[model samples]
Target chain A: MAVEQVAMSSPDERITLTDDQRRRRRSRSIAIAVILAGLVVLFYVITMVKLASTAVDPSL
Target chain B: MAYVNDLNATEPVPGVSLATPRDYFELLKPRVMQLVVFTALVGMVMAPGSIDLFSGAVALFAITIGAGASGALNMWYDADIDRKMARTRLRPVPSGRVAPGEALAFGIVLSVGSVALLGLAANWLAAGLLAFTIFFYAVIYTMWLKRSTPENIVIGGAAGALPPVVGWAVLTGAVGWESLVLFAIIFLWTPPHFWALALLKEEDYRRANVPMLPNVAGAAVTAHRILYYSLILAPVGVVPSFIGLASPVYGVIAAGLGAVLIWKALPILRSAGTDRAAARGMFGYSLVYLFVLFAALLVEGIVARLGWF
Candidate 1:
């Protein structure tokens, strides 16, 4: 039996992810989360450093 | 086909992308990024100034990402030729591990983010240079020069040599003569270095129709040209000592290294070009030559910064 394009499944039927696709998606998601967290830390550290430099020196 | 169709469709599909994080990382060309980061670090250290720890760290990070972004864009654009070249056949984009759109998007995002971060941490000049380097690599070299001329690497090399200048500008907020000295070494080093590998990869480049020196100019001309470049590179290699960037001892060491590099190239010229063993030896030594030269400069920078000298 020829399966129609799975992408057009009825709205009520949720699409099922293949195991390989799910695994890859999960790994990518974790990587993105780590990178985003790293960015947050980076911004935090930059702010502190800038604040400290200004506090230590008020000279023009 | 269905998956590809789903991806490009106007309505969002529920299918998950098969690209893994590692594939994305591979798209960055980590090895090239490492060299960019190292040279930029040397440039920063050699620049006469000071940076806070945080800002310095951020500058390096931004430069690294910028270099990787350019590498990704190179891969994205060259995916067609990469598929043909044995050396580049397994690259993420060519291997189908990452989609072309994904790689392009990844490169664009990193390029913008890196340049913005650099502007905040360093100065506008550094950021501008980084942005220019990306554009030069992705557009000027990859899109234009790479296909049309055998002298592609000779000119495209400028893009690679700009990292140290960007690094110097990060700390100094302007280009300096000392930074240009670093840039000159890389600019001169590039032709001989790439031509040596070009001799080895002649077939691969021919298959890809990339117009590498050997593919267009023949092996004899390529080998002779390599010799001429090496001859010029030898003296330039030791200019740091003459210019006060390094101790006289470092100069002597650099000269000795240069002599050995010239010695390695002799067999290629003696054989009337394309001596396989000579090319292999030169390729290996060329890597060591650049690394040691930069390492010596890095040591000088460290010693001067610490007042050990």
Candidate 2:
């Protein structure tokens, strides 16, 4: 039997993420990305410096 | 259906006139996704070597998608029980905002899409871990354990705890002791963390026929269990520091926070309260403790890499 669509109001009201919550989450994500990017670049530069200093010394 | 008719005809009405695709998206519990992503990211960071921006973004994206897929699948499986519980009754499927079939389809699609993409962007190992995580949560935890035993959360916590391992695999293409420690930290953290809330909402669990620890074992037993696990968890949480992945500062903070976690569990172990203030306090502090410990690890990791330590 095809049950008729019940007309009862929903017991479960959906809770959407609020604009403020979205903004906070977004900003936090961007901050983490920035920190990660900064770390990568810093690593690259340091590795390059150590390589260059070793090349100049050519001993030990 | 009669249920839908009754819902449409009820008092106070629903806050939204109709649930769109986005509303169904919210039902996937995106907040939980954020925590998973953060822990996974920390695990990736602490792994040996480094990743370029483009590859890192791709890895994080794959992880996020996998997490979202898991959430959708969880909602799909639990839709029936969710409708009966006051806490989960308002979820999209239970509330009639989204059909159950739609959620099932959404989850399936994300699951396939994320795993395939992860395999391409990261490594097969990481992708395999993602696949396993999804199956573990949706099948093992949801379909099997959730209805079977009071030990459900204890055993099922593994699914939730694998993100860091997934994160580590993304870079190294293998699981090592370092990532294992991260996994252990979260694995041990989950039971005490969730049981506190379960204690607070014992009645809700009972109403839904879900055999949470407090409902099955009594509040005193549940509280004592929480204390025992928290004591073990505190020392386990600090193991990474001794292994050279973290600094002394992480050790000190972890010990302090671990002490505080035990302190929070102590009151509840002694007495059950009508208001749930102790459970609430534990729940809140647990969030802060995990966040602080992970953040400390990240800071120390960066400093050590920079030779500032």
Candidate 3:
């Protein structure tokens, strides 16, 4: 009822979102989160690889 | 289409606006960011030392994000002044499509994240330069100098000019004379490029109370300044060739481009102070001059690497 009331009030105060708009927003948020997580993983992997490459060989 | 309206809404939306992804992207000033990325890439390529593919890619990505962060923060802080300028009135923040607070937060997060990642991926020297660049643009230039001084663009130009140096540092883990030359070219070119626009938009700048050169000094003074900078920039454009950083062919191209830029500025100098057409032509040619100068370097570097020369 509040949403309906706000919708009916005025053009400026009301920001009506269709179901599709909401869905797109949710998807964009998820994509950003996933990308951030991927970057963290990448940094970790690269650091480990660099350290391992510089480590002394035990067999030698 | 389905529509819903609130009849009583009269105030500005308080972070409740439906901003799409594109609005957020626009806040990054993608056009400016593209030039930043291109110039940075040329610097990296022209550097003497070689960088591994993975490291180079990561460094470039970090620099790109850092450039975007500065753009976002600039928009956040300049929203009020931007609203008064015809050229910037339609930007995301001034256009009411994005919340200013959101832009600030986005900028800060990206700024920190990009610098840290760049340090980890490449070296701290490059990261330090990038961090200082963001600070210079956001705080020194945007917050302080822009409103306070007519020479704001001259000082703020340092922020834009440092990308090449940052890129060179990423590759060599140090700064060199070559990178400094690249930085100088852009630094000197900035005044003529921006002041030409200022000449045309003098009224808009006056309305916003921003102390652009044309607003503080008269148009004749601004035109003379543009000519002075352009004359200096023309010779500096060919410095890379003299230093052996670029081939002689690049020297010829740079000289010709610089000549064209001088020719463009001549009209602005000869015309009456109110000549928008001359100012616009100079502004447009300045863009071409910088792009082609860098493009020549990029092409020459590729040719040398391929042994095609």
Question: Pick by lDDT: which candidate is best?
Answer: 1
Off by over 4 Å in 1: A1-15, B1-16
> Candidate 3: lDDT of B98?
74
lDDT of 2 by residue, A1-60 (tens): 111233435784343434443454466467558756975774565456546656888892
In candidate 3, stretches whose alpha carbon ends up further than 4 angstroms from where it belongs are A1-24, A48-60, B1-12
After superposing all C-alphas onto the true structure, candidate 3 shows an RMSD in angstroms of: 4.4
| Complex DockQ per candidate | 0.35, 0.11, 0.18
Residue-level lDDT of model 1, residues B1-309, one tens digit each, is 122223332222334355788888888889888889989999999998899878998999999999999999999999999999999998887776677888999999999999999998888999999999999999999999999999999999999999999999999999999899899988988988999999999999999999999889898898888888889988998998898878898898889989998888789889867589899888889989998999999998899999986
Worst 10 residues of 1 chain B by lDDT: B1-10
Query: What CAPRI class is candidate 1?
Result: acceptable
Return whichever of 1 and 3 wins on TM-score: 1
Question: How many angstroms is residue B117 displaced in model 2 relative to the true structure, after the best TM-score fit?
Answer: 1.2
- lDDT at position A27, candidate 3: 64
- For residues B1-309, what per-residue lDDT tens digits would candidate 3 score against the true structure? 244344222223443544667778888889989999999999998988876677788899899999999999999999999999899998888887677888899899999999998998888999999999999999999999999999999999999999999999998999998999999999999999999989888889999999999888889989899989999999999999999999888999999999998888887888745689999999999999999999999888878767797
Residue-level lDDT of model 2, residues B7-113, one tens digit each, is 33212233322445465567567988888888888888899866655666767877887888888888888988897888888887777756667778878988897
Q: lDDT per model, in order?
A: 0.87, 0.79, 0.87
| Ten contiguous residues minimizing lDDT sum, candidate 2 chain B | B4-13
Tens-place lDDT per residue, model 1, A1-60, is 111234444555444565555777899999999999999998888878878888999771
